[model samples]
Target: MIGNGCWFEFDEVRGKIIIDGPMTTDLSFAAEEMQKYVRRAHGMFLPIQRGVLSESTQNAIVVRIMAERLATVEEDGFAITYRNGNVFIEGNGIRSVLYGTYRFLELYAGMRWLTPDHEVIYEPTDRKVWIEERHDRPDFRRRGIILEGVQSASYAIGVIDWMSKNGCDLLMMTIEFWDEHQAALRPEMQARQLRLGLGGHSLDRFLSPGDYFEVHPEWFAWYEGGRVAAQPCFSNQEGIAFLIGRIVDYCRQEPDMDTLSLFPNDNKYFCQCPSCSTQSFVSNYTTFLETVRDQLEADGQSVRIQMLAYNAQIEWTMLESMPEAASLDVMVACWGRDYRQTIGSPAGDRDERFRRIVADWGQACSQRYHSSLSVYEYYADYWMMTSLFPPLARTICKDIEEYRSMGVQEMICLLLPYEKSVRIMQEEIMGLPRENNLADREFNSETPVMWLNLYMFARKLWNSSLDEAGLIDEYCRAAFGQHGDTGKTLLYALEQQLAQLTVYNTRWFKLRYTDVWIRDHRSKGKAVVTGVSPWAKEEDEPEIPAERSEVSRRIVEELEDVWHKAAHQGAHSDESTLLYQALTQYFRYVIQKLRSIDKQSSAQSKLIRQETEEAMSDLTEALQIETEIRGWDALHFAHRLRDPNVL
Candidate 1:
């Protein structure tokens, strides 16, 4: 024991994990975790006891859910302090109790929960543990993840467990599959006090055309001089009433649901009838939400309604006449912003518009509306930029700070799975065949770049002022052990190359096409137009420039040099070895892909075909290696590589 009170020591065989609060499931879970970790680290099982400890008990670890402490701490906040002869882990709520327990294990035992299935436990060399008094809370009130492309219950549960360990407070999924997952997911979510949110692009579910269009054709949207099932006719009072009734029923059925989205379909189709045409789509949407809110309130339901400021609803001018509801949440989806730059720094016209939209919503929510605001960011948008990992750690950190300054209460990002293999279900859901499914590919190795970005995003959400470099260094040392410095050097070099490549692949290509289109139209003495049809002639597309191939070649060489240096100079532990092997294989695939692209710009058709075949072969080999390592087929989405037409 140190100082006046006995601090809980790792090697304390007599220490008892005391549950001072009511024996709830979460508290019991926390105690069990503490007991389990202590046993794993010290080869000694600490007995867990209920109620108050005897006077003779010494060096005990007490866990409690102190509801009275809510006055001092947030509901998810926790405190660890030494009192008398015991160490107390007290929290404002049951979930916080689990959080406090994890923090305790992390700080004193040097335990790191790096991933869902992977963790690093550092045993003390001297068999002694140091203790400190700490109080902690998240900077963002709601740090969450919106589940996409994930199907398995086991994988979903794994994600929830990892979220609980990392202090994530909310998990959202689309309403279409809530019934499929809720039975398996609800218990786990409830134990962790994680807020369950359902609904996305699901206005159709509430007022689907299939169920009502035949009988009520007038209820559907009027488009191109005919009624379409794309959206409900917002001008029609009966249609709005039917939609609200369905929403109310859903809220009543899923009482555990914290928030429900009333977003339009994943398209720009809106009612073009004279009544709806009189106002913007956003104004009509606001009126519809207000009606729904009124009905929900009348029904005495307290579930929050989520609305999207996306696509057609992105313009701030559309929101001029909108009213606010305290229970309404405005999720500004930053869809088209350049991930290379922070939101405050506009990369182009689209980015500038998105920034303005975000700012307008923020100001409206703070000054006029008093409604909760959140950002739906796309850091891991695999669908848009397949198999490309942008270096967005600094951008992520800065973005969170900007959002927090703008009075945003929550930040939710779309994250891809880190699992090595997952089973692919039906084609309709995944959009890839089971036999040749690119969406179900295995990673064969750990994706450190993506993992680091995710870790940075989560940490920044909790503490905006966190030092990015320091955090990187900490993760590197923990992950790579003694050769962490070399690992850091390699990672920095990799990011630099990736930053250049990402710009070239995304921004430059976009600008190049626009420039080509403008030049072509000017040469023909025709007006340059927007929203060019997809049916435009293939010959109109510009060929890949020689300069792009040269740039890719230079990047490939740099990455190869970095990989070579790290492999030879950097010492390796089992973890580092795995990391390096996975990175090496991924780098090999990247190099081959670049070579294939370089060959595509060649004048010879024979060379292009040969390179394409070789690249495919390389990918197949990499996947085989991954399968050999994991002994299973890992489900990963990499449609770009799998599609021969893309190559």
Candidate 2:
């Protein structure tokens, strides 16, 4: 029986899902997903039927590719409406249909995919569904995360599933690893309709030095005084032709590859030959891109070519000089930009340079037929921060708004897995001391803080107008239930503490190692090791300011209090409990790390070593908790603590 003013009644006995269009894989998957979620939420299996429905199918959930109706909708946009005793889900394309189904489940069923391993579903108390018409689309054309470091095939598949559930449409893997795991990864990606992108500093792979250095040395870059096998000689016609041929053959082998990146070797090494030196690296790179685009077109291949605006290629003048090509995608990499602040708010010269580079690229990409501007971000780059959690949700949201305003259509971030830690733990079981293992563990586990940043990044890329605070609260609620407010407080407190600690570290380092020393070493093209004071005598080194040490202590105490309160409230589910344990252990590790830093400045050598040992023990506990929860080891700041004397 239909109630008054009810658009559709979700009757367990009579209601059904009606597919009103040709069934594609994505469409079929969407129907199955809808059915599965409905069953989970209401203990009702809504029978799925493909074809025109009879009049008796009154209270039905209708899904179709209403391309004609969605004339103005983006290719991945969707519309959902409830009218005439039925719920209608419509999209302009197959991917949009799947997105519509997920969105419907989110809005009406209260479902959330918080992390790769965490899902929350809330059942509707009312059987009658009532909703106004709604249409939704992503603000960015390509929203995705790049898999970096080492990971298992199953882990990669889990990330893909999470991306699909969150409406992320792109999945980029480095070419070297993708070749090894594509067999197990491609099917999962195909079923979800996620775009596959392959490449990352992969020019070396296509034209390795070992293969050509002996036969044709001209193929390598001419650096300093002679040729070096760092990168391909972009100006060499023969080398360019060989590189193009290899790329075309690769595309031919993998016809399903949506994008191929020809990013140069991951360094500032560029050809210094007469031909290359006549112009900037960016200009040479642009020529290489144009040349590759021509080759791909001539070969009748449809793979989009990508290049990085990184290192020596980030010059604004060079970017401005290049002519626009519709076939080229430029991914601007933010390697050294400060993550503590938004890109729109430049706090230093480096930040301003990155901002200008992105703006210049945006202007350059605007003339292209396709949205070609992309950003290679590092929100979850564990290696860069030595495995510390980067609390940058608000910064990421504001930065995305800036990018969107600049006509940037795509964004991908580096997200590493915790497999290295798992491998180390297995070795530890064989007889290695945990402290001995800490010295080599560079990549660590993804903490809750990292997951939160990734979650907010994905959400903001889709909807730029979403409030960061609201999203944080939403994630906390989904992850912690009744203790969500406490969880939110703890997260904000941790972020504030980390931000303050960054400031403290900057001040401490500057005081100990004069800025003049850093600038002089940089000018001499020498790598200045951080935390190593240039003073010849140990007594000349500055002491840690008493105020900074006190602030550090206060931060540790505050975090410990909040962590205890949150833990006391407990989690709402089994997964939430595991997350809570990880968070608690990680919090302890952070506190100990701060203590070690504080002690290093003033305490005796023995005291400093003791603090270091305590920090390592706490980190090991956190890693153990992570392995139990995720079936893999997560890395942390153990490497950083290995030499406490340096701090």
Candidate 1, pairs of clashing residues: 420-634, 421-634, 421-635, 422-635, 444-626
Cα-based lDDT at residue 575, candidate 2: 49
Stretches of candidate 1 off by over 4 Å are 1-6, 24-26, 122-127, 312-327, 417-432, 436-446, 499-540, 543-551, 571-577, 601-647
Worst 10-residue lDDT window for candidate 2 reads 512-521
Per-candidate Cα lDDT values, in order, are 0.66, 0.68
lDDT score of residue 296 within candidate 2: 84
Best by lDDT: 2
TM-score versus the correct structure, for each prediction: 0.82, 0.81
Q: In candidate 2, what are the lDDT values of residues 86-117, reduced to their tens digit?
A: 88888876678788888888877778887787
Candidate 1 least-lDDT 10 residues: 510-519
Best by TM-score: 1
